[model samples]
Target: MAQKRSIFEEVGTNEVSKPAPQGGLIEKGRKGARKGIRAWLVVIFALVMTMIAVGGLTRLTDSGLSITEWKPVTGAVPPMNEAAWVAEFEKYQQIPEYVLQNEGMSLSEFKSIYWWEWGHRQLGRVIGLVWALGYAGFALARKVPTGWHKRLLFIGVLGGLQGAIGWWMVSSGLVGERLDVASYRLATHLGLAFVILGFIAWYVFLLGRSEAELLQARRNKDAKLFSMSTGMLHFAFLQILLGALVAGIDAGRGYTDWPLMGGQVLPPDPFYIEPLWRNFFENPALVQFIHRVAGYLLFAFGVVTWLKGRKSANKATAGAFNLMGALLFFQVVLGIVTVLHGAPLALGLAHQLGAVALFVAISRARFLSQFPKSQSVREGL
Candidate 1:
């Protein structure tokens, strides 16, 4: 055997262990945690999607304003006794919605709407608690890899902001000449929820693709793929915003037919309401028409995106593209069904959930396309 060497003795330069590149330690730990966190994020994202769907139900049922106050802490427990329930109902009776729209509403009637709003608020509270606890546990346990801690914290902040915006939305309805929330404020609140959902979906996709560089390390192919995928996501977001506008104005109540709205491609009077721009946000017919048109356009774009992506050799790119195509098809079908059914509660809620799923698909595709697998890196490994 060779002579025993001292701990610090130079074993020949070539025999010495090489230090890993810059992000090596972080990357090493990242691989193990990536799958776990990706799964967690996906589950959390699904929960958020469900929350949004429930919110859509609340809005569709006109139950969102039933709760007259926002007591963030106490509100979570709900009204537990008859006296408490009466107090809550009495407060709602003073609101414009009750005075102008639901006058003579009985206690039982009040409870119907109150339960929906209460459930909505309760869901929000639970989501906040879950996010805080999960994020704190992950951070303290060092379960999340390096770059993701900041992002997880940011998501928590957005969730808090969502709570504030939800109250802001409610306050809009509680005061002023109108008994309903301002359409713009409603749109803004819903839009922000979608934004948060999109971020979570995209981040989860990125985590899943962390070990793959089949696209990013390759300049030309990857850049074009990323561009196309990102464009799809942008269109998805735009369509969701348009959907929110439709929901805000109660647009689904009109044009109860498929393929045509009152026998015209465009409503007979698109901007018959107030200022011309107001039609886009206030006129139910026009809002519904625009939403329908946007759906068609989004479907077309999604199909085109899928077709283009199919030309790529990357499996993730191809898979994501196919998923998007399927989701868009399902969404279009659901939209038509919802319309034909006169926007029945169940169908409308399903359509809303479909939209969220489609958005997630588009976001996932974009993320994966942006970070495809790399052959060079694979060979080295």
Candidate 2:
């Protein structure tokens, strides 16, 4: 027999021995700590940005080949004394970069470049360690959101691949007659870096909001704006790769004039390298010329994209595109200044950082388009 409710109790509800309420978090609450994961990703993002800057410095200073070996673990401990320094310097001398380019360089001079390359490699190690530890800890604690374990793990895998790619890029310069890494390889390495950065950045954005919020926002997405912003992101990445080619062969330093490469509509002797196809990578003028043309076209497309993006019914989406447009315009000016100044250390690094900034901006705009916030009628108006 069950206990029955009184007539007075019937006014509020029927209580015929109803079940007790469930305790603990429901399924939604069990989704894990999104905010904590987002903060960790932000830290990685900053480190990678710093890595790019250090890499640019290494290239500008011609210090990339100073290490001459890829000892992933042992190399972390740099030269400890004079004898070890001499031994390392001796190894560097064997490479064409030192033999043909820096012959008779003093130990002190070698040490300078060695430190830069060493620091770059060390930073890479730190990034890997951070990612590994973060993922492992989160995973072991069962705090990673369901369905996201693989995504977070995929980033670590890419980081490992990046290490291999970094070694591949460095190895090219250690061979016969090559004063630097293969231009294509350098571009590949940098292209992958941006790819990794893109993943991390997108994840950060996604994590900034709750899963429910993102799902609801997705319903309000501006499909056209998303498509346009995706295109813009790809174009910016292409420009970044082109910039890498220019850096690989020091092409930026070769043509110090902007708008016109040395006062010509086109860079002189664009086909100086034989085999026709070889000119695209080995020819300084051709690489820089292509890079310059690409920048102008990217800017033009960005303008068209911006005009469309600013009309979004969602203010947040519009603001993202607006921010992207501003960065795009400023980046163009920065490139010209970088070229006019012969791609010196400070300007060269600044230009690369500018690219990173612009890349993030475009990414943010794309994210907003895909997950636009809903607005009230008054705000929409």
Estimate candidate 1's RMSD in Å: 5.1
The pairs that clash in candidate 2 are none
Query: For model 1, how does the per-residue alpha-carbon lDDT over 129-157 read when each residue is reduced to its tens digit?
Result: 87887877777777887678888888889
Worst 10 residues of 1 by lDDT: 211-220
Point out where model 2 deviates above 4 Å: 1-30
Output the TM-score of candidate 2.
0.94
For residues 1-381, could you state the per-residue lDDT of candidate 2 as single tens digits? 987767666564543776788754454665687888999999999999999999989988999999888899999999999999999999998999887989989999999999999999999999999998998889888899877888898889888999999999999999889999999999998899899999999999988887777888998888899999999999999999999999999999898876788789888899978799999999999999999999999999999999999988888889999999999999999999989988889989989999999999999999999998767899998
Write down the lDDT of every candidate, Cα atoms only. Answer: 0.81, 0.91
lDDT of 1 at 208: 59
Model 1, residue pairs in steric clash = 213-372, 213-373, 213-374, 214-372, 214-373, 214-374, 215-372
